[model samples]
Target: MKCFEKLVRDFITSSLPASMNPLQFAYRHNRSTDDAIAHLLHTTLTHLDKGRDLSWSRHTNSLAKKARQCLYHLRRQRDFRLPSKVLQNFYTCTIESILTGNITAWFGNSTKQDRQALQRVVHSADQGQEDCEGPHPSQQ
Candidate 1:
């Protein structure tokens, strides 16, 4: 904690008098390995098995919930006689965007369960999009 104390001391002297909020900081105990810290980057950092691993369970679950909500909206618009292209645009903007946001950062390391959960969202959206567009010309 010396480093943190030194930094706080320096900042207080150089800038306006500042105070630290005890609740805003997370400290990992020497004997604890299950502690996790979540940051604004939409991912959780965990120290497990003596190594640092990024857990995407929470992030994926959140994305799936949002994407499913978007899918509901897409289906509603389709029932309202919205154009196929407009529905496609909506899916792209809402559902797809949520699933793909920062994908490269966490997807590669995500567990299979997390990946499958996300895939289910995509699959449902795909089925909705297909229904929105009707049967393919070749299938007729």
Candidate 2:
């Protein structure tokens, strides 16, 4: 467990359903599109809450940058490894965090497809591949 993972876990779990048992997926390691979306949401929230004086635009942009960077690392590096569950945890939390960081805009809004689309672009660019039919491995 990395420090970033812990921070995300503490922050996201504090507000999410206790029964969600994010840790339970430890053995089922995978890094799918849905996982990424979930991570972005959670991370965006955590970053917004913890990142001092950061505006919504900056927070979202920063997350996007991080997501892109992770994609690049995952594809270009052989040892760029992380537990599937851990990465899934990170991705879901980050996604939720970024979206809801803006309390004013989080009131019953939706961006599932939009976020997935962004992830697709990042994944494709990093892998030099076309659209993935389903969830990705838990490597990136």
Candidate 3:
């Protein structure tokens, strides 16, 4: 068995009630052989064979997914010729919230790749905003 799997098994066997079935527990795995991870409250915590470690890839990926979905809706509203103010409001209310939610907890610990991925989401939204600055279809 892998190191992480063994560690998880050991932890479960020790902490859980004997009467409770093991199948009820949910452990997050990326199929990695050396680490155990878990998802809690939109955050991901990881344990590695090297030592206790934190991995934010899962958390950042989920944030990117939610932000992209919000961006998609923002773009759709832009295509519909919604006013720039309304679009800005939508972004603030949706995408910004997704990107910033629990940011203080994970942003500092997140890897460079994960941080770059999130930046791309915001950059895409910025590009869309630049397009909005031009004469609107109705105005032109």
Candidate 4:
């Protein structure tokens, strides 16, 4: 068993580049073991707190920050008298892309609170745009 373990470790080390630190997490009974698997690089693996419950807060926070920036720029463009269609296209390209890109992979892993927070951010952006235009043409 020890020899087999060594061979597996060796294979892993050989497969990955020297710059990367391969994290070996042993999952049993929906819980990760406390063993220090491998520490080649200085960076530790993220979202290892509760095994199956992968925390997406870091990724979601980054998305939210980016969305906020896009919204700020969109609002600024609106101030400069850009057409509503152009602003909508900008929102679709920039803000929506940030919100929906890679969503399928991480959405399921996100907590309810995290999802709600993201939804709120999106809603706020929509509301902000609507407020600037006094209701969309579709609504009228």
**Could you list the CA RMSD of all candidates, in the order they appear?**
10.7, 16.0, 13.1, 11.4
Candidate 4 has a TM-score of 0.58
Better of 2 and 3 by lDDT: 3
- Error of model 2, residue 99, in angstroms: 4.5
Where does candidate 1 stray beyond 4 Å?
1-54, 137-140
| Candidate 3 lDDT, 59-102, residue by residue in tens | 99999998998888999988888998998999999999999996
Who is ahead in lDDT, 3 or 4? Answer: 3
**Candidate 3: Cα lDDT at 76:** 92
lDDT of 4 by residue, 1-140 (tens): 99998788677657765554334443222324433422311123343543654578888888888888788888788788788798889989999999999785578668788888788878877887787789888999
TM-score of each: 0.59, 0.26, 0.59, 0.58
Error of model 3, residue 60, in angstroms: 0.3
lDDT of 1 by residue, 76-103 (tens): 9988989888988998888889999978
* Comparing 1 and 3 on lDDT, the stronger one: 3
Clashing residue pair totals per candidate (backbone < 3 A)? 0, 30, 0, 0
User: Per the 3 Å backbone cut-off, how many clashing residue pairs does candidate 2 have?
Assistant: 30
60-138: candidate 2 lDDT, tens digit per residue: 4565666566555444332345444544454445543543454444332335554554556455443432222123455
lDDT values, one for every candidate: 0.73, 0.50, 0.77, 0.73
Highest lDDT against the true fold, candidate: 3
Give stretches of model 4 more than 4 Å off.
Answer: 1-52, 136-140
Error of 4 at 104 (Å): 1.0
